[model samples]
Target: MRSVIDIVDLTAAEIDGLIATAEDIIANPAKYSEKCRGKKLATLFFEPSTRTRLSFEAAMYELGGNVLGFASADSSSATKGETVPDTVRVVGCYADIIAMRHPKEGAPLAASMYSPVPIINAGDGGHSHPTQTLADLLTIKREKGRLSDLTVGFCGDLKFGRTVHSLVKALLRYEGIKLVFISPDELRVPDYIRDELESAGADWLETASLEQAMPELDILYMTRVQKERFFNEADYIRLKDSYILTADKMALGKSDMCVLHPLPRVNEIPMEIDEDSRACYFKQVKNGKYMRMALILKLLEVE
Candidate 1:
């Protein structure tokens, strides 16, 4: 079996296929409801989570599959100092597939090396969240009608936003995609990301002005300034409100542009903007479940 430690682990064609499968699942719910009736999914989240964990569980349940595993390290063998490979080895014996989220970067990658079952990376520190990127791609494809030839603006905490990094990498593979990086200087997109974009000959621009960049975007992706990723309280405080998407900001964006957040949003996106037609963050969350369901099916080779 194959594991998805990074978005690049799946080719553009594979991504398209997953999006197509998700769209199919979305359109015909009953047809796929019992697709994985006998399967078991093991979620090994060594970090606290809400959306990602619940989404994976919900997805497995919707497929008629049973779910198991802890939501945090304290609840798992890791609290007793058991390592990732040791844990995955045990979990693999019980489950058909595994989805793991860890605080340490590449922990899932390391686990994948020894996993007897397919390993899905839920989130690995600030490294990558490939499944979330799948949700994002499916959302973009559904809302915008295509992933290519669109200007997408990513605002807020780019430096530590794993979703932003993963999505940016995935989007570069599409044709005619232009990226707008909107963040304060302290939280600009990482250099490696920029370097990758440059090497691929992708069009991208970095800016500190969210409002100025909004009008040009077909998709406006807002990310939270994660308090958990900060080393200094002062730095988090100063940058937390750097890019709030108020109604005024939404008005500046194109009328049909979709707004997406990987969610558990704090105050970056105002509740008032949620009523606007452009707000698709909640839809993104729903799409996430469908995408995960598609991914689990694809990885398990279940037709």
Candidate 2:
């Protein structure tokens, strides 16, 4: 009955364990080559995606498991008005496990409630993305050597970035974690997060300028501001380049600073900055596969 619906459901120790497992897999890939042999993972993605879909397929395939199911909702029975639970019930008959991504908030939770097979929430509507949080944790652990007592900055559209919200909640569990949010007023982190940080006693501050936060950040997490997240295109245009991470600006960051992006970045980060040694988004992505391998193994073991 165990399901991954939120980052908070996993404790700090469990998160660390997943990170360790990812590292272990990276070190010894052959040991896990046939870990999930003959198993099937059903990916029920309601929205279209290249990265998440590919990553999940890669993780399952590398573990000797077969991947089946729809890449987009239009191709699935869901387009015929199939309910989330109904879809899960049908897929459960075929899949040893299910990983779902949906546009509706709590859709995966609804799937988990009725699914006979284990369910993993791939992503949900502005809600939570726990697996991405796992990738972020693995990245943080790999680059910085630890998670707690560090300054982390979040830049760009915080209000709608599910990854940002999930990561903030995940970081709240650690001791002495401080957060710096840099964004225009309209795109700043929401009040719920502000309240969560305050209640958790985690030190946090807001800044309109990325420069002010760069010097203090041990980790800088960047996210894009979508035009849809705003009411008008003008606002998106005006602030689109406001948070751009350039080589010149990166010089202000701490010597050990690691830059991270959830990927599919659009102009928020300069291409030149990609060459920087501290840019860990690509490595972050590679770790995602390993972390997901550990997660697939663990969730399948939970019963």
Candidate with top lDDT is 1
lDDT of 2 at 101: 94
Model 1 misplaced stretches (Cα beyond 4 Å): none
- Across 1-303, the per-residue lDDT of candidate 1 in tens digits comes to 899999999999999899989989999999999999999999999999999999999999999999999999999989789999999999999999999999998999999999999999999988799999999999899899998999999999999999999999999999999999999999998889989998999999999998789889999999999998899999999999998888887888888999999998999988998899888988899999999999999998999
Candidate 2's clash total is 0
Model 2: per-residue Cα lDDT over 152-179, one tens digit each: 9999888878889999999999887989
Per-residue lDDT value at 298 in model 2: 88
Best by TM-score: 1
Error of 2 at 160 (Å): 0.4
Reference-based lDDT, residue 165, model 1: 92
- Please give the CA lDDT of all the candidate structures: 0.94, 0.87
lDDT of 2: 0.87
